[model samples]
Target: MTDEIKVPDAGTADKAKLTVAILVVIAGVAGYYVLAGRPAWLRWTPVAGSLALAALVLAFSRYGREFRQFVELARVELRKIVWPNRQETGMTTLVVFIFVVVAGIFFWLLDLGLAWATKLITGQGS
Candidate 1:
């Protein structure tokens, strides 16, 4: 029989990430206290440590492959996104303005017609 080792489960990965997050937060707070007004290198210690912790958490997850795949899919979808060009956007705006103007004219005409009809029926117009 062939033998193959199963990778860590999703729960394990999630737990690892949680633990890493807690450690990062603690480390960041400690670093701030140790070097509150220190130089760039001292300040960067915690910042870089947090980033490294995030990397380790992600790396330790069982769903790491799936997560990476989803990120890749998102990137591909972004590439396929079709942004409207300036000319097309301008044309659409112009069309909307024209439609609004035309609609206003139509409503105004309708209102005037109704008013005239009412006036005629009541003998208000000579």
Candidate 2:
């Protein structure tokens, strides 16, 4: 088997639906800016309406249904996780902080040694 990610192609109708959904959102944004002098609710009408319309249009698309299924599956998987307790979390955080400080010190010493070597070889530190 090849190590390639394979994505299924949505058919022509689904592609058209997705395109219309995108255009609806773009038009809504443009309308919002174009109606900037209007009242807040009036300006927001197109934004809200377009989002709802876009979502409605997207519901008919194949990938949209797949996304819904993915979200549902994710929720099921999310519930199976055993999260770390507060004490375990604190210990892990402390270990990470200690390693970071040690790494920083090691890098700083390496840099200083390299700088000293370069200056000595070139006699440019004066």
* TM-score, every prediction: 0.49, 0.70
RMSD for each of the candidates: 9.6, 3.9
Report the poorest 10 consecutive residues by lDDT, candidate 2. Answer: 58-67
lDDT of each: 0.82, 0.95
Best by TM-score: 2
**Residue 20's C-alpha lDDT in candidate 2?**
97
- Highest-lDDT candidate: 2
Question: Which lDDT tens digits does candidate 2 get at residues 1-126?
Answer: 779998887799999999999999999999999998999999999999999999999987897798899999999999999999999999999999999999999999999999999999999998
Candidate 2 segments whose C-alpha is farther than 4 A from its true place: 1-20, 36-45
